[model samples]
Target: MKNASRLFLALIGLSLVVPVFADKDPNINAIKARQGEMQIRAHNLGPLIAMAKGKMPYEPKLAGQLAGNLKLLLDLDTSRDWPPGSDNKSYPHKTRALPNIWTSYPEIGKYGKDYATSVNELNAVAGDGLEALQSKIGAVGNTCKGCHDEYQEEHQH
Candidate 1:
């Protein structure tokens, strides 16, 4: 009985120490670089999305190129590749990312899905030709607004 009690106590003590001694990721630098790339690509995405929406004067060829770019960006595997904090950290980058993104991760993911859907819709319009592109531009813009409303900072345009 005494041995059992002592063993239990030892196990408890080890559990307490294990977390404190656990290693932190040493790959922060690599993570930051990947995050930076994500930000650059993400920033460019807005304009492409906008172009596809025909917010600017429409050229079918330009719209097609923008659609391709948007698809490329959407396809990037962020699971292991995207860095942390390079885009969202408060001081260094003036990112519009809302604090709620990390807090409400599920909702943020939903916004990502919505963004992809909007991009796909825009692509379809582009493929259909500029005549069908006008209203869909607003539809894509709404996705941007939805994401920004929840996940980004307000900007005065």
Candidate 2:
């Protein structure tokens, strides 16, 4: 019985140590952070997209609030989230970021700047009226697509 208890305790200690080692991996943390940021952006944008598409009732105040939240998220400096070895090619199946992002840094930086501009536009007029929001949604989406097209790997069905 004492041996069994010691074995169980040893296994529990190993489990705790394993996660500590995993957390020390910068590549894993970078991928996780970027994925989390994308998830947050999606959460903030979902309702705005639905309203813009006429799938949801337009609420001007809510739209403004969501857009503001999205703008704040976009304004964050996420350079650390794309560190070396975090690309899809290096960490296959863990990230969708293409290696091209590092190679074509200037182009990707432009895309990021454009995305920030789109978010600013959305924040400016999201509360003005549905028409205004609808007008800018396409620009915001296009900015997203511009980066995704070149920097992200295509998803398989």
Candidate 3:
């Protein structure tokens, strides 16, 4: 009976371990590449935000271009297969994403939704001119900060 019990436990352990070593998903790699691209686009939003904050001179034409770019980036589907290294490996560019992001994926998705909403609103106002958009900048600015505060490292600028 003891031998039978030991055999049963060993099988159960293998059942759990087998999947971890299963073939890696190609979709995950594609998703990781897309995510890397979005990170670069996200970084570019800073200069536009700085202009709105009056840290730099505001150019309505440039603001419109930046706003359009932001809209495109925010509209991307960022959720794809969880990148492999995201679970355990930390890269130089990666911020230590909270583990809860994996457990609570829906909540993490809300941050993207919020960003999209803000970008849409910003784009509407920015289309007219910088002055028209300046007042609404705070709402959009907070959306960027809201996600980065949790998911990204602090930028010097």
Candidate 4:
């Protein structure tokens, strides 16, 4: 009975140590941070897209605010959130970023510049009128789609 009690105590001690010694993913936090940023982008862009589509009534004040939010997001320095080896291939289903995002280097920079251009244009005209918003919003959406098509895996429904 003493031996059985000692064995149980030993097993409990091992369980406590095992987790501390476990190989935890180092890139998980970076992946989550980047994902959160994208979610915020989508949250800000969604209303503007809806208004542009005429599905939602275009309120100039709201249009300007949402576009401003997207433009503000562009100013965030997110390089750390996109560290190498944090892609979906490395982290699997935890992320949708493809390995080519890192492998392709500055090739992706053009897409970013394009996105910025689109967002800036949208921001300038979003408060002007619904017609103005419609004209520039497509360009912004296209820039987003361009990057996602190249770097992000298709999100499964």
lDDT of each: 0.63, 0.90, 0.69, 0.92
Lowest lDDT 10-residue stretch of candidate 1: 82-91
1-157 per-residue lDDT for model 1 (tens digits): 9999999999999999876555254234444545586566566556655655556666677766666666677787765532344345542343545556666556678877987887788677664665666546666668767877876666657
lDDT of 4 at 53: 92
lDDT value for model 1: 0.63
Model 2 C-alpha lDDT versus the unseen true structure:
0.90
Candidate 2, 1-157: lDDT as tens digits: 9999999999999999988667877889888988999999889899999999999999999999999998999768888888976888888888898998888777788988899999999999999999999998888889889989989999978
Q: TM-scores of the models, in the given order?
A: 0.57, 0.86, 0.63, 0.83
- Candidate 1 clashing pairs, residues 3+ apart or interchain: 34-83, 35-83, 96-153, 98-151
Highest TM-score against the true fold, candidate: 2
Which segments of model 2 are wrong by more than 4 Å?
1-22
**Best-to-worst ranking by lDDT:** 4, 2, 3, 1
Candidate 4, residues 1-157, lDDT tens digits: the string is 9999999999999999876555366577778778999999899999999999999999999999999999999999988888888888777889999989989898999999999999999999999999999999999999999999999999789
lDDT of 1 at 119: 77
- Return the TM-score for candidate 1, rounded to 2 decimals: 0.57
Model 3: per-residue Cα lDDT over 21-113, one tens digit each:
653655445445656866766675776778877898888787878888888776666555455346422444443344455666667678878
